[model samples]
Target: MCRLFAITSKDPLSPMVAIEALDVMREGHDGSGVGLFLRDLGGPFDDMKDAPILSGIFTEKGIRRLDGFMMEIGFMTKYKLSIKIPKTPPPGVPKRDIYLIRAYEYPEEWEDLTSDEKYSRLMNMRLELRKMGEEKKDMIVFSFWPDVIMIKEIGDPLSVARHLGLDRKDLMARVVMAQGRQNTNYAINLYACHPFFLEGFSTMTNGENTAFIPIKEYLISRDFHGYTGYQSDSEIFTHILHYTLTKLGLDIQTYKHIITPLQDKSIEAHPNGNFLKHLKHSCRRLIIDGPNCVIGSLPDHSLFMVQDRKKLRPGVVGGRPGMFAFSSEVCGLDAVIPDRDKSKDFQPMHLDTAIVGPDRQEVSICRQTEPLPLLR
Candidate 1:
């Protein structure tokens, strides 16, 4: 199993905090890879929240094409984060031309476009770039969203961070999610990295998704182009989230129901039985059957954790006011917030979705057996 670690703070903090937390639970993961999703960014990126940030590694040739395409499409550069590659990278890390995180000004024609419209435009752009890179082995575009940055590489978590120069003070954020990946069911593929992003939402998971193919078919069957990468079985978790919240216009609570719905008797016992029954029937293909723990962030920067129906995976959330973390183990949590109230640290069981909103206050537990009253 891979170890998951995520933290959201009222102020910008180094990704090192989360990376170090992952180190405490090092035994859980095999050091095959590390993935990070940084949102509500701080440092140099804090002011460019409105511009779409294109994050990925690119070869010399790949960046040339990318520059030409951006110019052709009228996406002017607003700001760029430059990384200085170490001449001698840590063992197992690949040499690259550029590790870029650039914020871009939208096309002049899109100035009047709605947020959703801009999201589609950015998604299409990233997909095009990904295909370009795949055809010639040039680029690996992780995320093309505003205020969100993603970095993924195959190596030990700390080594990868050092190689990427991510420990630099400029690479800070109020919300950050990192995964110390274990190659559990597939080979190492950077595109398959955790903390998958789409339309401002991002998520990463430990364990597996036994219902991958069906969920993939159902999601790709939709008109959305961002749902095409099935490189990892765990990626479906993020797509299901984007689909439920944006495409289906459902609330966050409904997300848990879609991915791990209650059984017939449990649904019947639920206060919103009819609603849940319809949900289960309509989104049957989206259910996840494996033992997994999902840590994710919504567009609003709220962080949440969900336990699988079987609750076989270990995960916990703990922090004081203005800061909170969701970790694969308590030791991981202690690494970051040692002074937090241990009594309030929550380890979600089967059918529980623990959430810490953007405000970064205490976690609010929402159990399927006793969900929040806000169910719609």
Candidate 2:
């Protein structure tokens, strides 16, 4: 019963826009936690796009450890934006020494490496930092990537936003996704937050993944280092996306097919029926088996939402030419972009994939019955 809200604009907007929308969408699903993914960054991060930004919470000791580790790894801190928290923060907010987002220059040795190699190193660094933090409860690393910053907190959306000082204009992005978690898992592990990121792909889901174990087993067998963590059942959706795009060279459209394939006659009707049949057989383990709606952003900055056939009214996308948002309820969209034409809003059916290209001009629905763009 989690609420999902994501918006993309031609120009950067403060994260508060999404945060506030999350509040409206919250309804009864308000308190578990809040997770945010900001991409196509604006403001202070625009000039530092090439530098990798490490974002998370840090105890005083953790920050010290992080400084030493970066030096050891050859990363030089270039710029930083440490959120200002008051001595007495909002109620129920956990004690945090520092809420930090810092960008780092790549090690000189990486200058000669290919893009993929550098990405591999970044992922390893994130995992290493996460492992180090877990051992001592010193750091809570969410994302370690270029032009992206993630903030995850266990309080309600607004409280988390205020605690992080998200009202400040310095941190802004053209694309952002916020999730108000339903708290199915009560341990409150921040790592389990939605909108999980890997390499350049990110996704947030709103329902249970009935096929979680099977999908988890399949991803583990891939032996990809990035598929190592499964703190939240929804995390696999992002990995599957990264795998389909990076490993299999399949386009985003193919993702819908792999995760929610058509059966029998439906598949036989597509021009790529044979390919899809073989695909359904080969990747059956990856198909979702229950209610779910996934909202995700690709490396190219395109954003999308997909609904499980069983998920009724999972989400809606509406906005003008320069900006568009997808929300679990239209009220959330109304909360943000009230001026947009209501008639044009799209509520994707069970078989629809609503996508907004990087331009943010319009949402193009890719129905499962239509032929997905050729394999690549």
Candidate 3:
């Protein structure tokens, strides 16, 4: 099993906090790779929250092509930041030529378009750049969005962190998710790394996804471009969250019901049991069948943790007034916030959703039997 660490705070904090937690839980993961996703960014990016920041790695030739493509498409580069990789690479890890984080200004023609339209354009552009780079093995674009930056690499979590200059960099955020991936079902493909992101939704899981194939088919059937890649079975979790919340227009709690719906007997106990029954029947493909613990963050900066119905994996949520941390184990939480209220730290039971809102006030636990809001 892999390990997942996430922290959401009222103030900007270094991802090293999450990294330190992951290091404590290092025994749980094999250290095949590490993926980091940051939101509500700070440091240099704090002032440019509105600009789209494109994060990726590129070859020398790929950099030239990227600039040409952006110029052709009317996005002017406003500012650029690149992570300096260590010259003497970590043992067994390959070095990347360029790791870039660039902020861009949209074309004047796009100034009047709705936010949704601009989002669509960015997604399309990212896909095109990814495909172009894939053909030549020249580049890999992880994300292109506002107030977000994604970094993934194949190596020991701490080693990769050091190689990327994460300790020295000013990169900081109020919300950050990091996963120490253990190669379970697939090869160590960078894209296969955890902490997958699409639009503003990001998710990372700690167990194998037995329901992957069906989930992927259903998501791809929606004709959503971002749903096409299934490099890892866990990728479906992120897409499923996006599909349920954004595409289906359902509330957050309903996301838990869709992925891990209540059993027939339990559903019948609720007032909206009939609606849920029909929902389960219609969206059966979305139901996950595995012992998985998922940690995810929404565009609003809320952080959540969900355990599969079987509760096959281990996870704990703990924190104080100004911050919350989710980890696959209690020791991981202790590493970050040791003085946090131990009485409040509780492991989520089967089919439980633990949410920490943007205010970093308290963690709310919603069980599967809880009556969900009526779908719009």
Please list the C-alpha lDDT of all candidates, in the order they appear: 0.88, 0.89, 0.88
> Candidate 2 vs. truth: CA RMSD?
1.2
Candidate 1, position 172, lDDT: 96
TM-score, every prediction: 0.97, 0.98, 0.97
Q: Which stretches of candidate 2 lie over 4 Å from their true place?
A: none
Candidate 3 has which clashing residue pairs, if any? none
The candidate, 1 or 2, that scores higher on lDDT is 2
lDDT of 3: 0.88
User: Clashing residue pairs in candidate 1, if any?
Assistant: none
For all the candidates, what are their Cα RMSDs to the real structure? Answer: 1.2, 1.2, 1.3
| lDDT by residue (tens digit), candidate 2, 41-156 | 99889998878999999999999999999998899989999787888767766878898899998888899999888889899999999999999999999999999999988888
lDDT of 3 by residue, 49-92 (tens): 88999998899999999999999889998888767777778985
What lDDT tens digits, residue by residue, belong to model 1 across residues 1-376?
A: 8899999999999998989888889998888889999999999888888889999999989899999989999999998989988888788787788998999988989989998788898899889999988999999999898998999888899988877777898899999999997446777789888878878788898888878888899998997788888898988888899998888888677799999899899999888998889989999999998788999999999999998877888999999999999999999988889998899998998778899998887798888877546664
